[model samples]
Target: FAGIGDPERFFRSLRAGGIDVARTRPFADHHMFSREEIAALAADALREQLTLVTTEKDLARLRGSEGVPDDIVPFAVELEFDEPAKLRQLISDHLYKARERRFNTR
Candidate 1:
């Protein structure tokens, strides 16, 4: 979650999706957890009764590495656009205007 840009954004999306997480564990972007670190975090999670949740990219990389806990899970994130039709129309208008200007200049 924190491995992705804006850890808060990931939490916001999780809440929007109705995943009621009480707290977060943040990691630096593109962080690779060592064997000892993974073991320590996994033990802490077990002690705290918390699940290890992370972004898909982190899970992917972690899976590739040795000594990572198997319990760490990945969550998928999707961005939603507000007033998608209006945004599409605005983009279309901008593209048309730019095209007209380019053609007119020729």
Candidate 2:
């Protein structure tokens, strides 16, 4: 299950990692999972004998919810930039300009 802006991307990542996804349940980006919804998902996984997996973002949202099963797994991903130095420089330039503008305003 995934509740993210691009659930397909998450699913694709799982497939790329060689995980055989038996099923999926996607929700709107940042959709808060209610206890009942969690229960239903749990029931489905139990019935199918499959594990529950979700993205880190979704796990953050489910943190405080009651009856959240301990077996639920959170999938974490890291971004790999093709040009790390260029990307770092771009971010540095953007931050410098934003800081300059903020200081100039004062």
Candidate 3:
């Protein structure tokens, strides 16, 4: 999961649905993240051996900026059906295709 307006609601919904997602990164809505913030986040993700990602909304905010380093990865979260299982599968498929597209280019 990514930038959520309400963390409690998110957790509650997950609990109600019995979904077991391991990690969640939340950002302030339309957050203007600094270079230091991006670096720290990238370092933490690397330290944990986890994929580093961000939302398209956050990416849009960062556009026309020069401070962001090249290593950070931007991830976009798309909304589909409200059903949990369906949403999970859709996101998984999207990520897989996105990853393939990203890595296949030279």
Candidate 4:
């Protein structure tokens, strides 16, 4: 949780969800990391024995750069829709309407 948004919220969620985070470093949303900075952060994480877990969006932002250390793990948010059928129906309706309107132009 080291990119784009307050890491505190993530840490709080973790704690609430029963994760014991030793420490955290938050950065601006869509933060750009330099090779040197990444190296330092990686070293710190290893030295402190902290598991580096970040959002998938942040991992993607890194663009598979070698600067990103291997120990860093990508964390993904599980999307839980309240009503799957209703949500699916809404999406289907929106798509259907969009397609109908697009092709109806004569």
Best-performing candidate as measured by TM-score? 2
Worst 10 residues of 1 by lDDT: 1-10
lDDT per residue, candidate 3, 17-101, as tens digits?
5655456666665556777877776677778876654455566666667766555455433556669998789899999999999
* TM-score between model 3 and native: 0.46
Q: What is the lDDT of candidate 4?
A: 0.79
TM-scores for all candidates: the values are: 0.67, 0.88, 0.46, 0.68
Candidate 4 stretches with Cα past 4 Å from truth are 4-9, 60-64
Ranking of all candidate structures by their TM-score, best first:
2, 4, 1, 3
- Model 1: per-residue Cα lDDT at residue 37: 74
The runs of at least 3 residues in candidate 2 whose Cα sits more than 4 Å from the true structure, single-residue gaps closed, are: 100-106
lDDT of 1 by residue, 15-104 (tens): 888887877767777776678877877888889898878788778888767878888878897668989999999999999999999999
Tens digit per residue, CA lDDT, model 2, 23-75? 98989998989999999999999999999999998988898789999899998
Clashes per candidate (backbone, < 3 Å): 0, 0, 0, 1
Which candidate number maximizes lDDT? 2
Q: Please give, for residues 1-106, the per-residue lDDT of candidate 4 as tens digits.
A: 5776777777676677677778777888878888887887788888988888777788787768876777677766676888999999999999999999999995
Q: What is the RMSD of candidate 2?
A: 1.6
Cα displacement (angstroms), candidate 3, residue 34, comes to 1.3
Residue pairs with backbone overlap in model 4: 4-29
- Residue clash pairs of candidate 3: none
